[model samples]
Target: MKNLICLTMLFAICQRTVGQQVELPKATFAMHTGFLFGVWGNYEARLGQRTVFLTEAGFSFQSMAVFTNEGKEDVITPVLLVGPRRYFKSKISKKKSGSARITRGFLGAHIKFKPNSFFLDSDGLYGYANHLGVFPNIGMKKTMGERFVMELALGVGYAHYFAKQEGWPENIDRPTVDLRIRFGFNL
Candidate 1:
């Protein structure tokens, strides 16, 4: 059933990509940290001058604390930050021997999903929570130092968790802050 859902979504994405007849530049790949946690990478193809089809994947190892004891778990995450990437147009030139670095900033929205993991408390009781959510994220990309280019983005979203058989509270508190940040370089 899960495979079916994933295939359906994949088909939808393929349809969108094939439907567009615009000729654009090749895809760009990037690796970054701060996407939820750990390291993540993305493949972005320019669908238009200000539009991008961004696909990202990463993993996060985290420990969560509820009203009970903390549980350590591993989660897999994939995100698509596909939307209009707002940037300034026109170009500037310098008369120096070397050209100056160009920096651009953008704000966009994305939809994301994370796989669940086993959560074991101190009492040996365990449960799992899988979340699917969306958030509005903003980021900037520019040259730093002489050769490094970096991008950072942060987003906030509300997630609902479904747990298995455990006396987990009926009204559990949500995370005080559900934010995702990614710092990576354009490749």
Candidate 2:
């Protein structure tokens, strides 16, 4: 009787351990290659089944070659962003038919950086231009599998350029748009 009881207890413990092994979702990292827009790739990490941490770094290159205006040169500006995200899983159906699970939801608040660019006048003289600004962002994501995910986020914020710069219209301010994407493992 003593041996039977010990064996039964060990079996129960093993069963519990096996039950605790939950498979985690996959993660993703992606780049933005849109027209007139150049962005670096974004990285994300899944934590505790429903939350993610994100980081991104890159630069924007705006072409001014077509412009008949005095400032005709390409601009290279650095970009950096970081933030936390949360997701909600969708309910599953009771039907016996095999089907893939889908997850979708909103995410908010990551820090960002946008630097200013300088331009030259028609006479080929360089002049100081608008300064960069920092912005906070909010966004969303959609997943097709337990291991793969994709996200789209939009950020809005204010910016300030130097008032002393030449040709900078008075009372002008900085406002920017941030767009991002992610593709990688979910775990």
Candidate 3:
């Protein structure tokens, strides 16, 4: 009977010493810009302890300043991006305090598509083209508060153009770069 009582007391002591685990967000929704030159809406879902699946969609209306030097073409199209993000465990994330700031670095691979991209050239003439690209990126994310998150990322890759322009050659391809700033909320 005395041993049973001692075991019960030991169990109680162990339970008191161990704290509850912090719950991480399973999903997030964000508004971002700079991927394809316009505001984008993003949804990210946690796929594992350190991995997330991300997607963004938006309409872009801007000049082809990054892709072409062919007389400043005005491009209007819908942009879609899909990728997976992997987070690295950090010292800040190991803290148990409620107000602890979590900063994590991430790596990602993305594929972007812009279909039926309509453009107007310097002479005020219209044409059609499709753009597809693959970029590998790296970034850092910080938790501002209980719900707010901010991130900055950069990607380098190549973009291929599929259309016959007035004077340019068919199937033109160029090197591409993407820079993004994101603001998000946990859900």
Candidate 4:
């Protein structure tokens, strides 16, 4: 009986040691889709303990198919974005909290490429130009689950364009707005 008790105690101690040594699962990658009258998707990769890399792509379409005079036209725009994100770590609960939960703020830049805006024949008459610009954005993200997160961000930047007319369309340079909602999952 004494030997049995000694063996049982040893087993309990071993179990406790093993339990205490268990490590928390590390976050990997996440993918999310959001809708704000339009659909957008984002993919994020964990870089380190406090940083992540993000890539985003999306498009917006008009419902009415109308052309200039009397036809239907479909206008679609595709965008690609890349940036580095700094994350804040929370002590409360890693599984229930997102990296943004602990983030104080972040700064990043993105470039947008737009095509199908210019016509060869209208080059000197009514011409459309492609735009290129850089923007710095700030935002926060909240982790609701181990694999789910929500984020909101806003940014203001400038865009440069080539104009065909010298006086018309006075506003050749304009300020742009960047508003976004993102969802992510661990890969």
Candidate 4 structure quality by residue, lDDT tens digits, 1-187: 6534653454344334321121223434556555444445666566754456777666544232222343344444455667665443232334333432322234445565544343222113222345455555667665554456676777677665544332335435677777766665555
Candidate 2 vs candidate 3, TM-score winner: 3
Q: lDDT scores for all predictions?
A: 0.50, 0.52, 0.68, 0.49
TM-score of 3: 0.67
Which of the two, 2 or 4, has more TM-score? Answer: 4
Sum up the clashes in candidate 2: 12
Separate clash counts for every candidate: 1, 12, 0, 6
What tens-digit string does per-residue lDDT give for candidate 1 at 58-152?
65545554333544434333333333343322123343667544455554545565554443444554435555555455555655433345665
Question: Which is the better candidate, 2 or 4, if ranked by lDDT?
Answer: 2
Which residue runs does candidate 2 get wrong by more than 4 Å? 1-28, 47-49, 61-76, 88-101, 115-136, 144-150, 162-173, 179-187
Best by lDDT: 3
Regions of model 3 farther than 4 Å from truth: 1-24, 33-37, 60-62, 65-70, 74-76, 91-100, 117-127, 165-168, 184-187
Residue lDDT tens for model 2, 51-158:
577787776665433123544576555667776655433433232455444545444455665434434334453434445454444455545444555556666755
RMSD of each: 9.1, 15.1, 14.1, 17.9
| Per-prediction TM-score to the true structure, in the order listed | 0.57, 0.49, 0.67, 0.53
- After superposing all C-alphas onto the true structure, candidate 3 shows an RMSD in angstroms of 14.1
Better of 1 and 3 by lDDT: 3
